[model samples]
Target: MSSAMFARDVPFERSPTTDLPVLLPPRPRERFGWPKLTTRHALLFAALVLVAAGAAFAQAPDAPPAPASEALTTAPATPLSVVVKWAPLLLKGFIFNIVISVAAMTLGTITGLMLGLGQISQNTIVRRLSWFFTQFFRNSPWLVLLFFAMFMIPFQVRIFGTTIPLPDWMKAIVGFALPVMANVSELLRGAIRSIPSGQWEAAESLAFSRTKTIWQIILPQCVKRMLPPWMNLYSLITMATVLASIVGVGEMLTLTAQVHAAEGGRPELFAPLYGFAGLCFFLYCYPISKLTQRLERRYNVKT
Candidate 1:
């Protein structure tokens, strides 16, 4: 064939009519209709709608004044100032709560340790009594126990010729401690049970007494297991201390409510005040939770 004929046979040299349209891979099908709405998108849309509705409500002249104590109130223009003004008083109450939590936890832990050891006693009476103690406190509602402690426990006792008076706060602590002690006893029981049976056998071969074996060998090993749960329980107890308000303990929530009332029962202050209280609690509890997790990981204990 001549050079011109060869040129015509080149792949690019087909007749225009014979040429196929160069179709670029259909432009990825243009994901038509609407974009798939994700949780994030839905939330954002909902938030925008809420904001618009709020703005519209705010602008409505004929809207009735909201009851301060009833609804989720609108914040005042100066929320920061309100927080700053009330924060000092709230801090003092929060400190009181801390004191109660710490005191209750300390007493509870000591009592719980004794009860836990009692649960595993060889004697039937001791074991049954310990079980009874645990069940009684564990099953009882905290509020009921609080009321019992408040009402049943005497206000005064003559000890060594001194009339010692039990105040409401002290009584509240005793009430809180009962539940804490019970739960801690369970924690101890579980931890002790978790130890390998061979360890008990080994202790026996060494001629260790039951008490000695527990105190010296078994308990030392169980400490790591018990620690995470103990800390977690303390955190729970700390949260529950808010219930002390029922007995007039004057903790953070109680004082916050008082402060809210004192601030003219302004509907707007509700969120900021309560939100601040919540933030305080979160600050306290979150670190504890994180610490518990870390201890759990470090000890390789799931509890």
Candidate 2:
């Protein structure tokens, strides 16, 4: 009985014709260098060798001088020296750019606050007037506005027998401020509109006047929504200050051009000096952009 049970439990071998799944081994991780160099590795190695050879040739003492005519026609070859010599002046001009942007933005923000509120005024005339102002400034090309402020605005104003002449930089600032005001007004209007009707109803239930409700309750909430856009606008305006050079505002670009010319317009200096100017703008604007993005995300505001 024990021998019979063992034979039954052991079972029989499978028939040769029976089909079974084939189990393949996992693929070996493809390697790159030496004995196992792949197409990708070959290409990368070739590129690296070419770069090394080029660098060695460049540093070699026997390297030939550039043709005199080519050298003369091109920008300065030594940009670092030029930048070193002119850095102070460029920095001064950059400071002016900063000052102008800040002043224009400040003025624009104050004016925009009033214009935005006026757009929602109970009186039809006030609303229309605000809309007209916003559209006029918004639709006008910035260059044209700059030209108008530079030329059409009277240079001298007589107040109590006192005559004052507006400087070119001041006119540029005012020109820039108009567009900023229009944009900020739109931002404010949108932020206010974004609040739920429930908020307005709640304020009204508290017996608050419209102005009081806006100032005390509504605007406080809108601040979070408005701040990110406000910072974004400032960055744009900061970059736009470069345009002031067209009107001879003596800003960084203007100084760069002057320095480049002073440096004999050498081809080598062209990239370095201009690149330095661009770097300055980048350094100034990049942080603002990052901050704006962070604030927008934190407040869950889209603009």
Candidate 3:
């Protein structure tokens, strides 16, 4: 055959009849919009487990009790024996501690309310004086102030009667309360300030006096805000009773100290004494703390 005939016979032709769907790789299709867990994620998971393990490993192994610090080591008192013999005495101290907390909380609350009002009072003089009182009491250490009140106040014959023989418990009550008053005062003051100015204006427009507006409108709002702080203050008051122990007030802590002295500082006896004392502290404060937290959440919604 000729070359042209061969070329004609070996023909190349193109046709258009496509109807197939485009396909992607299975790797991307299998994911279906899911994110890939990279090496970073695996490393993060490993690091978290390591951190937890390291934390557990870091704690020192507890050793057997040393004899030197044994409670009642030198004729130290035993826990069981102290419970049998001295429970009643310790209970009296516990009651005194409760009394101090109650008295201080109630009186301090009243004083705090007054100071809170003083902060917003129209009288500049009253406000200035209130500020000074709040600053002084809030900043001063309770122990120093109490010592001064108990031992030094008599020299000046300033407030409490000069000839009066104040009980150790009472002295502590007043001294600790002075600071708590300042604390509550500040809480109430902040709450009062937070109330919208529009509320006061509305009350005034309705012909209400300043005192009447506060009593009716402002106090309710302040009270709600005060609940958590007040409970916190109560806990502080409970702890503050420990200071009374130092002044020979015979509170729980003092009783525990007495037991400790009698125990000859044995770890077993002393540990349990202070442990029980610590437990008492928890008993008094824990419920209040829980209640405060609850009220905070509740009142936050209400306000």
TM-score order of candidates, top first: 1, 2, 3
Local distance difference test, each candidate:
0.81, 0.82, 0.74
**Which portions of model 2 show Cα errors greater than 4 Å?**
1-77, 301-303
Error of 3 at 192 (Å): 0.4
| Candidate 2 Cα lDDT to native | 0.82
Better of 1 and 3 by lDDT: 1
Give per-residue lDDT, candidate 1, residue 260.
78
Cα distance off (Å), candidate 3, residue 12: 77
lDDT tens digits by residue: candidate 1, 101-131:
8888999989999999899999999999999
Give the Å error, residue 123, model 1. Answer: 0.8
Against the true structure, what is each candidate's TM-score?
0.75, 0.74, 0.69
Cα lDDT tens digits for candidate 2, 1-303 = 975575566544444677432334565854322233369857865675455445534543442577877867653334456678789999999999999999999999999989999998999999999999998998898888888888887878999999998888999899899999998899889989998898899989999999899999889988998999899999988889888999888999999999878876655456667767877897688768777777766789544
Look at candidate 1 and give me any clashing residue pairs: none
Better of 1 and 2 by TM-score: 1
